[model samples]
Target: MTSDAPHSLPDTLFDTAVVAGVGLIGGSLALGLRQRGLVRRLIGYDASYDVLREAEALGVVDEIKTKPGEWLREAELVVLAAPVRVLPALARELAPFLNPAALVTDVGSVKSGIAAELEALGVRNFVPGHPMAGSERGGVTHARAALLENAVWVLTPTDHTPLTALSRVRTLVEELGAAPVVMPPDAHDSLVATVSHLPYLASLALTHLVARDERLSLLAAGGFRDLTRVASGDPRMSRDMVVANRAALREALLRFRRQLERLEADLEDPEELLAAAQEGKRTRDSLPVVKRSLLPQKHDLVVAMPDRPNQIGRVTQALGAAGVNIKDIEVLAIREEGGALRLGLESVEAVARAAELLTQEGFEVRSRR
Candidate 1:
């Protein structure tokens, strides 16, 4: 079932895709890929035979196999949608059986470790991806086709990675209605440690703090439930994330502690506490309103811009003057010389017009939608 050439992919990408670990992420990916006609046959493998059978029954996978390695022979793309801790071993097992040119990827939360391990295994086509999408709910039974829609899918590709392979994986991700963001392995880990892993840890701690009070549990309402919701996620997955990104997580934890200490210090004085609370509300209220765009009628138009003073204001002014109102503007990155800006608009035409106007103003702009 191996592909003959080392550079070619199957004609129809959705014709066959093999997913290891038919749990929530894997099952959802399979279903989404199928619904979008990205693949015709979706084969799945999981440690739990019962879950595998259920995936098959629910049409999450066209076929379910007990041995994941067996399916790799025929799969054009192999997605390792397992826990962070199990990624290394899974890569090892799949490395020996994978089609030489098959684009291999994963949905692991952390990337550096797995990327290094797979690179060492001679898997040059490996693309370590992490979809910044998930719910507190766990297991294959909760899988939904729309889980990845409008979500961010980050790809960490090494220098040795083939461009074609990366593009293939990007297409697959996009077909499932997810955006593919490329970043360095270390950057991916560091970013997720702050945004995902650290938050999960904080949620766990918050839950523990409240769980100790019997009265609090009895009177628990929406705010407490909302804050501690992530604590209900799979304990094993949460533990693995903390361990995998320990260094970054430690830094995040320290910063969090410092913030907490500042809050505690303020609480010692009534006026100080009230002022601090007011400041929090003021800052929160000042956040840009995320309105639905009337012009760019689409997801978002991402553009790269020079990191100069007044660059953002200039771009907004240009669009605003042209009657192309921006729904939301986000600065995704700020490098030494340039930055990436993501503009949420209601129409693609508005984005094109904005790009033209920015270009005319002697600024570089590129569509990143």
Candidate 2:
């Protein structure tokens, strides 16, 4: 919706848009299309009559269909906004109902399995898409029209996928204020399995384990709660996700387990533990920063400090001397001699200069990209 998006919107609008599920993603997308004036009419279909009714009452759809065939037949743009396990089956069901030229896309997280299923169904009009946007909460009641803004909507187009289908989906994603990323189906599945699936499973494991310990439950604070927040997501959907992407998720789990094992092994050795923590800081620093807001930019710099008075002053002073503007600074990971200092800089160039200055002052600094 903004002028700064990488993709430009098509002046041509959809005549009839059909959303297959009235959950968080489906509802949010419907709201987005309505707000953008990209669709003349919106129709929704859901397994739950109550949810469908609610979606209609919320103005998410102009029409609600009791059966898939009733509405999907008229759609110029069909969004299969359902679970990954259900998408393949839904695609099969949607086959006879699809308009010869209708563009079908999905919000399912994993893609390879669904892509294969759709490929076998001979659905060339469908483009497999995974929008990297969500919260722990589920359902349309918690959905917001702005949910997809600035989020990455990955389109996994197999060799069978038609170029027109992919283009239509990308335009829709842009109209909804999301960045559309293109990749192969298998690559999308493997990458998301680690970043998305693994985190949810880890949250599930931690929360369930802690809930069993009465004392731990009573004492669990911000850190524990924050780390396991995704466990509060819809359990049925979470279970479906892990089960659907078993092989990729399994590999990711193994890799994460190995790292945790190493961390556990060094718990007794403070020096090794600190070294591992520093290495983690560096690795995590190199990762792309998660976009939080469209405005108020801030770059985070993690600096290793020796335990001594005026360490914070030293770091900030160095940046100030280098003509770098730092927004804020905090102390973290206090050790015997020094600890880590987290600095917030105004811009990307400022971040580089601050890192250079701090390193010259004999401080180990890491920049979170």
Candidate 3:
């Protein structure tokens, strides 16, 4: 991923930065940059005037431009946050207005095609990027600076990319509290296909499989809800993402099919089925708890709270007040009058501290490491 080209530009603050398509990702990036004082002035452009206005009203940007023009000339950094399908056209449209020294990047999930296209279009400073963070919720209204905290941000620079441009982008990403990773565009797309794209498709398929079953609603519980949560994301956005990376996604689907076939064949053998289940459990448990930690050993606690208003809020607030940073959280075994909340903490000491705090608040807690 390293380029041999020399980077002559001195490190400096960006006086003017531009963000196109200020939706969730764009709005979040704008908020993160502005909150950190990384840019002197932030300008936003979007196809929807309503979005742009809302973004400005929310203090996500300093100015909102409905279309590209001379204002782009002042921008030292430009982030393209549009959907996967429209990124190429958006880059092409904004190319002429951009100054020669400006650095360009994007939040588009599919990068291989866009990277090649931007390079061919003579966008020399373009460094293709995709942030591994977001929610099922969409739109600028859902945008928050904390959404990107500790997230993995992948940067795929073309052969023509200058080392200076990559360094500047990487610095900005770090300032925004995200971990920056460099890789080839094709490799990035291929890796995300199995982990990101394939999971969304699986969620969609599972939801569709049970959509028409009238009896499933009452039977559906936390597990079902968790498994299909991605299906509830913006449909048009999901469609664009999957379609844009169809080739890699197709290969991922084939690999997944083979796994399912093997699982089916092992169903008749109890030992084989148990072994498969154990392997899955081990693998899932071994995944790093903290996104920034390569080899994390997470400590978990299950807190049971009575069904009451503000119970969940109280628990989290108590931990937050104590500076107990929770690595992850999930609701489990929800009942009509009560429920269990599983919290993942970074260290055993933190887990002990959290458990003690919650217990002092009269909540039942169990710790597992």
User: Best-fitting candidate, measured by TM-score?
Assistant: 3
Write down the worst ten-residue block by lDDT for model 2.
Answer: 1-10
| lDDT (10s digit) by residue, model 3, range 161-246 | 77567766876797788877778898899989999899999998888777868788557767898888888888998999999999
Reference-based TM-score, model 3:
0.76
> Tell me, what's the RMSD of every candidate?
7.5, 14.2, 16.3
In angstroms, the error of model 3 at 133 is 0.9
Q: Summarize candidate 2's per-residue lDDT along 255-339 as a digit string, tens digits.
A: 9999999899999999999999999899988765445454345597889877678888887777777788878765444343555
Backbone clashes counted, model 3: 0
Q: How accurate is candidate 1 locally (lDDT)?
A: 0.79
Q: How far is candidate 3 from the true structure (C-alpha RMSD, Å)?
A: 16.3
Query: Candidate 1 lDDT, tens digit per residue, 1-369?
Result: 122221244545655788898888988998888887778788888778999899988989988787646557787788999888998988887788888877799999999899999989998789989987887787889999888876778998887776556666776776677767778889988888877888888888778777768898866768888877778888888899889999988888898889889889988788988988999899878643322232124546656677678888888888889898788776544343566677877677877888788788877666654
Q: Rate the local accuracy (lDDT) of all candidates.
A: 0.79, 0.81, 0.85
Off-target runs (Cα >4 Å) in candidate 1 are 1-11, 68-71, 268-369
Total backbone collisions for each predicted model: 9, 4, 0
Candidate 3 has an lDDT of 0.85
Tell me the TM-score of each prediction against the true structure.
Answer: 0.73, 0.74, 0.76
